[model samples]
Target: MSAKIEVIKNKILSENWFVLRNFTYDLTTKDGTTLRHRREVYDRGNGATILLYNREKNSIILTRQFRIATWVNGNENGMLIEACAGLLDNDSPEECIRKEAIEETGYAVGKVEKLYEMYMSPGGVTELIHFFAAEYDEGLRANAGGGVEDEDIDVIEIPFPQAWAMIKTGQIRDGKTVMLMQHALIEGWLSLT
Candidate 1:
């Protein structure tokens, strides 16, 4: 059974970067109890992410960048390794991921296979990320991708075994990247032999 909810009030808290709104709503429980709740939600629009892998070489491409949020939280250096991802903006999920792959990894990827969509943080953030994967090779190299505007990204291509081990060693800590890597492993797309 799903609970019913109705918005009582919504006010803009901030829009410096994206949008932050304070919402007051009444949530009716299954037992007919209605409770008024107030919450602040951040809406930065939706996004998409992709993992680029080469089956023959058993290697995958990832990016390293400094994330301010992680730094403020606990990460000392805030340097994080993540799959190529970006906001959807006005493009479709597939199109957005394809563009992001090129902008972040320099790979004009071939046929892409969408894996799934997920809400990374549903409690306060309203971002639904579309996940995808594609095979890549040297023939698809478009440019030396390091992000477009203010983004400073470093592209890294590592062997599947080493990359996978980074998860245990706490090197690869991004959620979306970890999920995509695990999916590739389970699907036998990361087999060396």
Candidate 2:
């Protein structure tokens, strides 16, 4: 038998960039009881991220930008080093990651390998993040990518060893970025030498 839930109320709290809603529901339990619960959910839609690596140079492409949420949460300067990522926005996960890579890192990537999909913050946010990795070369750079007008992004290229070290030193704190880096290491796509 499947569990059943009925929504008692749904109120929109905000609808500026994305959406924030408060939901009240009654969930049927296995013990023949119904429990009522309330939760606030932030809906920003799903997103995709890519870690660009260059086997020839033994390096990876990353981006640094200011995140307002982190800043308000006591992250000193709020600058975050992360993999290139963006919302799906009517596009497939693979398509979104390709566009994000070019727009954020100036790399026109190809042949991306999909890693996994995860719910970033399931408790309060409704965002499913798709992770990917691709090989890149200098010849594939089409333009000087720094994101759109409102987005101030700085592209950085670092050796694989240095990037891995950053995670241990608390320099790279973004969860998605860390996961992709570790995936690369475990897959033997990176070398210590």
Candidate 3:
């Protein structure tokens, strides 16, 4: 079944960081019923994320940062452990993630395997995140990465078992990180032995 949508109006509510617009539209469903609704949409463009792992070391790279949104929403300290991620801006998904890995984790990754693309929040945010995985080693460390500019990020390298257990302990609640870790587990990309 397909739903036909017609925009009645699009009013820009805010244009500070990204964009927030109010959309009034008429949706005609397959049942021939038409309904008018208003919704707010946040457009921050697309993004890319990568899970960097070291098979030989049996470890993975993750970043910890303060997310204001989570803080206001009941997160105690707002510090979140997440996969290396960044907005695409003017770069392709692969290019963005590769660059992000270096900038955020100090690893200039090679041979990235793109897992898939997903919409983290399709209801309000118009951002599609391209997911990827790559192998890393000490030889690839270009710098003591803590992010550039005003971004303060902590690059943490944890053993595969410990990192996987973080999920159960709620220490790693970031969706992208969880997904990548699960993917690695399901595909036997890392193991305890």
Candidate 4:
């Protein structure tokens, strides 16, 4: 299956936090039909997310933060519970996740196992997030992490069962958080009991 695609025009819409552009492309289908399509793409760059779990305590570290986009999209509180994540800016996915873990959760995680990569919103957003998981303990706490600068994050540790229940209760609506938790459960990283 091969489709010929040609970029017709590109216009920058915004470049504040990231690049947002409008692209017009001419595509020729396999049936010899040519179509012109216009799409707006938001290039916020790729990111990395980590789920920190403590096997002894049967708990996982998560973060809650305010999201303006979610709030505008009918989320009453606009606050979302999510895994520790950050954009991989000029660093490898592993390095970014490790730094983000300590910066957001205060856990100086050593070894992070890369799980997979996913496009959270492939239609309009050009972001591929690298997923990771690591074991953490209280002894590895380096500092009281709540993110840096203007990012206000609340670190929360919830029992495995409770965390899983949040998904069904609508409390844990973040996709990445849900994916990581389900991954942990399916992989037997979390104690079933």
Q: Once superposed on the true structure, which residue ranges of model 3 sit more than 4 Å away at CA?
A: none
In the range 120-160, model 1's lDDT, one tens digit per residue, is: 99999999999999999999999999999999999999999
lDDT of 3 by residue, 73-131 (tens): 99999999999999999999999998899999999998999999999999999999999
Model 1: lDDT of residue 49: 96
TM-score of every model versus the real structure: 0.96, 0.95, 0.97, 0.97
List ranges where model 2 is wrong by over 4 Å.
Answer: none
How much lDDT does each candidate structure score?
A: 0.94, 0.93, 0.95, 0.95
Model 4 CA RMSD to the hidden true structure, in angstroms:
1.1
lDDT of 2 by residue, 1-193 (tens): 8988999999999999999999999999999899999999999999999999887788899999999999999889999999999999999999998888888899998799998999989999999999999999988898888998799999999999999889899899999998988888889888656
Residues 44-153, candidate 4, lDDT per residue (tens digit)? 99999999999889999999999999999998989999999999999999999999998999999978899999999999999999999999998899998999998999
* Model 1 regions more than 4 Å off: none
lDDT of 1: 0.94
Q: Which ten residues in a row have the lowest lDDT in candidate 2?
A: 184-193
